[model samples]
Target: MMTKWERLAHELRLKEYTHLIVGPGASFAYLTGMTAHVSERLTLFGMNADGHAALLLPKLEASGVPRSLQIHVYTYSDELGPVEALKAFASDLGVHQDSRVGIESGHMRIFEEHALRQVGITHLVSADEVPMALRLIKDSHEVALLQSAAQIVDAALTSTLPLLKVGMTELEVAAELEYQMRKLGSEGTPFGTIVGSGPRGALPHGGPTTKQIEQGELVVLDYGALIAGYAADTTRTIAFGEPSIEARKVYDVVLLAQETAVDGVVAGITAEDVDELARTVITEAGYGDYFTHRTGHGLGLDVHEYPSIMKGNPLVLTPGMVFTIEPGIYLPERFGVRIEDDIVITEDSAQVLTQFTKDLLIVGD
Candidate 1:
């Protein structure tokens, strides 16, 4: 079997790319097995089809880089900018204005691009496909890590749910949940823990706020945990005390949508099919206009990856693929309902990794 670097080189050759540059981010970490701090200081890993590989980073990080990589290293200092280091690395690899350089478009900042241009490295194109192609499938070890992460999140939320009270602030609930995750062996949160209560739940991506939880309100708790490098994202909506009739109705719709979406997950189905399963349910229930955002997104080393479960996505599902099944209904200036769960696609069926009960939960004192 060819190594990861060998596979990357083969891809570069196939695409006729002169060099593939990855930033000090997830792709870099995924490929090199070394996680570097992302800061203002420039850090990059450049490789070509000919098998030559090099890392250009700050002097402070030089010692930490593993010699096991057997790649050329170029270091820069704070007194001098990163352009000279980039130039030296680019020069050795014969990168120039005409070179077909590929970059991680989502991660590499504009300043990094400017620095690349300064070093005579132009003709940069989006290289998202190269890395994502390899990352889309989950291997055995990766699946194990993801399963562990899901367990951590499930346990944390279960523990935190009972502690919630009617008067507790959203921030307090978020903090307690995170604390429980830590106690259960999570290194950190993959994303900000969301505790949107009442009308605040209308914001799908809302983070925790100081607003106190009130009786008869809906609280949307969207959170995730990072175990090792894998992530597990899930959401659960709970009632503070006695939820309004409208809130209960919305929650049932969202729950049915989510369950239907998860049940539809099978090998060979397109991502769009999975999305439609949930969308059709919500749309038929008359909350179609309020059902904002995609049905779900891929989950792995990064919280969001390729093969998003949304409309018009023709990506086919296969065994070992993992993603979230989150369908939501958010009413403007009113409460919202979202139910999410992580699932892994198997040969015959999709396994729901998050074991938490999806019953319309009523929490808080």
Candidate 2:
């Protein structure tokens, strides 16, 4: 566990990055299992190609860093500032202007970049891929966290769906759903809970609104639960009552696409091929144009990760890889439908981690 950064350091050396600096975010927590508090203070996890690493943090946050990031801990007081500590960090690590430093482009802020520059390290590069490549594969611990997150989300969505009422506002539904998740033991939400109702469902990422849900309209409930820094994304579209024939037909198409895509997931298959499995179904059903967005995305420490399940991405699926298989279709100004499930690639096949039933449900009547 403490040696995780050793792998990243080796990758950096292969890429000729003499040192790698990570900031406080999912990437940081991925390595440390500790979330660094970031405000105006400068805190960083630095690793050199020699596999030596240290943490430079505010004195207040120093105690919280784990041993993984504590091989050499340097602290700066609020009054003294981080400059002096940073100087010593660079000097001890033998980092200089010529050292090829890399930073987490995904999470490192501009101010953090300037701080690194102030330390005389000139060859700073964006090496986000170096660590993400390691994170792409799920270890036993990460898989357990993801599975637990899915279980909590499943329970929350299952319990909350029956509470949706026709006249209930989308915000009301979202609130109930989120509250259930918390009561069921989720740490927090990975992203904003989406409760798009009726025509609002046409907006893929549209959030909950004050608009009231209506009878005979489709409601898109896209949500997830976060646990131990891992998250699961699941979306289910339900009809308040009997939906229009057109809406029903569209929903069926999306369901077919989503299920087929998930079933096709297997080790050695390309990510784009899995995407094609779903896209082809929708396209042949004459609803391809309405199906926007990629088939799905990788899910883990962050809501989105590597091995994008989209057209043109040739990333090969492997055992222990987890991602979402969500195919959606939005008929503008009408109702939309999306069915999503979290999937894990097995040795020869795949398993759907999210146990939420994808069947079209008639509810909120």
Candidate 3:
């Protein structure tokens, strides 16, 4: 079992920091097994070079700290201003003028950084890059949790498919999908559900609208489910009736492109190379300009994280790293098609996490 102290030690080495300061993200959760309800009151996990760790939080939230943390906990009453209390707490923890602190730049507020400075701590550095690099390679426990999340998303999409039909508004279908995901034990949708019918499908991030699904129109459903802080992203394009020849051609290109991209993912391959494989396929099909957005992005605690699959991202792929492979082709004011699946890289090959059928499904009178 990985103890909090052990996790902290790993982070210290990964970040090459004398001390670590964490906020309310996976880094904090992974190390302490506690969720910080970040707000006006600052919550932090601080660890020194010698592996000694401590937590500082608002007095009211102290009870929520897990017993497994096995670290010194300091809290400040609401009566005392949080900043003042934090300063005193830092003093007690021996954080002084010469302390080198690592802070999460992505989640740490500007004022909080200023406060740390006022308290006599100098040499603060961004710790996000280090943790992000570490998180790219998932441990066995994280992979198991991610697989479970993918299954939940797969079931939710399957159950919601039967509700699709001509005349149903895109917003209605989106609502039904959300309801199914919740009923299937997903904590919530990883992001806003996207339901695009016909021309709206061309917009990758198109939010659900009141436009009704028409016969022969291609509908794009892009969504994911959040389970225990992990996320799964998938997309499927289905038609209410027989698709036009043009739609089918575009869909086929996207499917082929996505397959090529997934095949490119392997241990030691650069993330950019994986994206190029898909882009090359789409370009050869004469739809390169139509296919926008990166091939994929790393997924875990946040829907989007490090090691993005885009041109120029030189991060090398490694076993246990998970991300999405989505290739899309859109025609303005006409229609679009996309096929996406989550993939986790292995020593020899990539494992597809999302198992929902990508085959074009036609449903209508």
Q: Model-by-model lDDT, in order? A: 0.89, 0.88, 0.83
lDDT of 3 by residue, 267-292 (tens): 89999999999999999999989988
**Per-residue lDDT tens digits of candidate 2, residues 214-274?**
9899999999998888999999999987899999899999999998898788899999999
lDDT of 3: 0.83
Candidate order by decreasing lDDT: 1, 2, 3
Q: Can you give the TM-score per candidate against the true fold? A: 0.96, 0.96, 0.92
| Pick by TM-score: 2 or 3, better one | 2
What would the TM-score be for candidate 2 when compared with the true structure? 0.96
Model 3, clash count? Answer: 0
Best by lDDT: 1
Q: Per-residue lDDT of 204-237 in model 1, one digit per residue for the tens?
A: 9999989999988999999999877789999999
Q: Please give the TM-score that candidate 3 achieves against the real structure.
A: 0.92
List the candidate 1 regions with Cα displacement exceeding 4 Å.
none
Models, CA RMSD each: 1.4, 1.5, 2.2
Clashes of each: 0, 0, 0
Report the Cα lDDT for residue 315, model 2. Answer: 89
